[model samples]
Target: MSNDNCTSNVSQSIIGVLDVIAPQIAKANGLLFWGVILVGVVVGIGTYAPRYRRHPLIGILFVAATTHFLPIISSVAASVTSTELLIHTILINDGLNSRVYCTQYAHIFLIFVWAGLVMMVAVNASVIVVGDARERRNIGPLKAVTGAVVWTTYLTISTLVDLYREKVATIQFIEQRTVANVTVLGQLFLIMYTKLIFKYYAFYKAKHSFAHGRSPSLVDGYMDQLQQLGDNSDTPTILKQGEYTEYDARLHPPALIVMGEDNAQVDNQPYGNRLKWIPGQGDKVLTLDRVWKLDDMDMLQSPSAQPKYLVFSFTLFKLLRCRFAKYTISSASFTKTQKFFRYTLIKGSGAAGERAFRIVVDELSFLHDYYNSSKPIYYSHHGFVIFNIILSLYTIGYCIYLMVIYIVLMAMGYHHSQIYCSDECLGEIFEADFAGKYSDYVQRPPSPVPCDTHADLIDGSKCTSYTILTWHIATTVFEVQQNQQQHDKCPHNVAATHLSRYCAYLVACYPELLTDNNDEWCKRLYEDAKKEAARVLSTPRGATATYPLIVDLLSTQSTHSVLKDGASLGKQLVDSGMGWEPLARFWSEMILYVAPSENLEAQAEAVARGGELITLIWAMLSHAGIDRK
Candidate 1:
């Protein structure tokens, strides 16, 4: 009894002591987070600038970006949502520090640090917040900007308070420590700054910055590798008469294993073919103006003229070398490699043969979030891969939360205030057709190919999904019939085919987004349509489902099956000889009709997967205050 009582007493005392010091413990926020950030920084440096040019680390960065989210949440909870965790403990006081008081060192040091941090926050935040033309998979601009504002504001406030403390040292710590809470933004800033700093140390400093004096052997050996690549490519000393152009648009870099060079050739959009310079302030934001580039000959003629694309040596051996032995690299010197790499990547032209290599590297870096460095997941470790996938999902959820906050804030802003924008900007963004209602399209049908060919689209009262599927089938039938007549793949042909297929895809794949409050019904409707489509469209044993047979059956049959209705429409379109341009216009209208959705759950899922076309259109419609009745 005595021994048990003693143990119990001691345990109670320890608990009592820990409880008393809880406030002080909470104040160790900066110290504790800094330790984690430092470790992350070190790990990140090794991950990106590995001793050799073996593989890419950009994918891993995206995967790892999700890591600090939980910690951020926990930190916020601990500090009562104050990100700075301004010490409320009465025992501790910042004003009492003798060394920090009104000294020359404090004032000068504060000025330098404050100026540097402010400049960096402005520049870095802009780069992060403004959408990059080259990077499609980054955290969207809204989230980036919001995060920047939140973090910078907190940090700025803290810095100002500290500066004031340095100058006017009398009992100000009481006022500073009395600050209640800074909110979730402070925690978010820590994660963002940690990521940004790590990126700076690993990618920018390792590849571009020349502050770190590079080794002699590293420089010499890297040049030799370049020489070997040049030799293997077989270059002429002088340009041929026809080969020379007034201004070459691109610069090709050396296609290294780390840049997905081993598998670049297999893709239609080759991994090594896309490159953009590190966007300076001069680089204009790539507008959403051209969603899908219309079929232009410039797209075709450009790739054919470049022979250096052949120089990329993609092999299974090289891929495996990058995958399994990324850390193990050739001992090469790179003293002047940073300058050469910069000029070769950022300044040179495609005729210079540096473009391909630059593309592979730049794409991997800029589009780190969207692409995996390796074939599947970049890292060989399955544990981290799975963990990252979970974190990514969490990050997506958080982004969606931010989006909701954005919408709420927007609504609040516009409740009593007028939205001010130029008429040109409004015209560009909020087109009437993008609301995509069937009623709206029917009211303004394109001429010459009268609404008779696709009368099903005239009824806005029908289930949106049913109309989409039926019309898409009809459009496909007509497209197949007209395939043998066209010489060139025109924009109309491309647009009609793409939109028709994509809308049908939404019907088959994303039915939940088509209906209001009847999710179960939407899903069941899809299954029924799918079954009907299979029954009606199925071909005979070892035979093709020809357009004529499909049209005849569809036009003749009178059933609830949407495919039959579609075939009937296809027959009308065929008889009318509907031009590709008009057919394309119909599809454009149909796509818009289907894009207006209210299913927030499906939308959230779609947004998490980098957003589908329908999702984008739906968001636009929501912004425009258009809704299905």
Candidate 2:
């Protein structure tokens, strides 16, 4: 009986200890309940606010406002609940002087709340700052007011919860209710945080996927039209029949002589522009269809006219790989703060602005190439590889850093900026060729000619005539003609000839794509070239004239005097040893770069019009990493 009594006394002592600790646990649960509500409100605001509309970072700012108020709202509720719980405990404890009292658990729970509050503040502040940078706007006042409210509420709630714990009586009823509240709060926090993380991850993954798949189409419909034109005729007409007239027929009597003028009937067969139907013994006539030969015509017509996929050389692939790797590494090395500055403040403009800038730079570069064929040092294949590697690595690192920052901020109740640069932005750069110094964010080498520098010397009229002259020179450069053949052999002449004509085609049909601000100049140039071509065609024995002889005649005639006067720019290039080969390569590359850089919105609007050769080249350049912004 004595042992049983001792055991009963021990049990009573344990029960007494529990009674003392029960009130503290209940107060801690109340604090936890408010914490859970804070988390729920923050998550809810962040998730829905960013999706409210599509205007840069406006939605993100809205999120910041809502999240900034989370602590204030939670703290006010906590204070009121603490007071109610304290009064209830005192009334239920039989007025036994059982007052509310602060405990170790209450301090620890307040620490958690304060820590959570600080985290939320940090998150909201970061979102606001970054969003402002990205959108080029300021909403600091909103952030400040919200932050003040949160801090005030937190201090007030802390005092009330502390007071409630210090005065409330320890009781079984309060303990059970508090425990249930804590359990529910913990579960809700887990669910909400998980959802927030998943949403951000999915968004980042989608952007990455889109960037990887943004290769442009390398071939278009223009090549097919050229091919059809080539296939219908075995021998291209070097000059129209009207170019040769029967003025006196004194220059070449052997060729111009006819057996009978009545039977020939001017031979208007239309089959051969240079061929003439001369009366033979009977009504038959011998047609000289292959008299004047343009060697480059055969080469130009040999290639397939349809659009084709780009096939990069092994060297090109290695160069591009190195560039991409370098960009990734450099980007990875950026500090969190640096990344925030870059993505937020530096690259704040949306994708549309970035693309527009790219188009302007590309158009400028295209015009520059028409007058200047000197390639930049960085344009070499080796330099291209190294440069791109550095750029790509930096981009990669920056992207990764951004992802981390986004995740952290979102977890802390800040919403991500919705107006991120997309694959379309990258696509514009790739299609546009190298970036220019005028770009706000991208650092590029200074152009030899500034984008705004108007080359008045390179009007459309001069460029068109120069192109025609270049084509003529390229075609007959290696011909076997006895009197006109030069000893110098240039393998690139054929390529130069084809590209020259193509440039002329672009100048005539798509002048706006090259220079939106100089449409009048292009139109004047086309009309002048057309008139000059007609004049050349009407000259006596013009059909039989060699390219060099034509150049000599053009040089003397005031109508085509630009060729000799240096206004055409071809004489300068020729004197500098940038013969047809180098000039052709430069123009070809320039044309290709400019085609896709034409305002993509404009191109999309005219999708039914037809494709351009420049588009094909743009795609090839993109595939090769040569045109990356």
Best by TM-score: 1
Model 1: residue 90 alpha-carbon error in angstroms = 65
lDDT against the true structure, each candidate: 0.39, 0.35
Worst 10 residues of 1 by lDDT: 429-438
Model 1 local distance difference test score: 0.39
Which ten contiguous residues of candidate 2 have the minimum total lDDT? 210-219
Candidate of highest lDDT: 1
Q: Which stretches of candidate 2 lie over 4 Å from their true place?
A: 1-483, 486-491, 541-543, 560-580, 605-607, 619-629
RMSD for each model, in Å, please? 24.9, 29.8
Candidate 1 residue spans exceeding 4 A from truth: 1-461, 484-487, 515-517, 539-542, 556-560, 624-629
Query: What local lDDT score does residue 228 receive in model 1, on the 0 to 100 scale?
Result: 39
TM-score for candidate 2, please give it: 0.25
Clashes of 2: 28
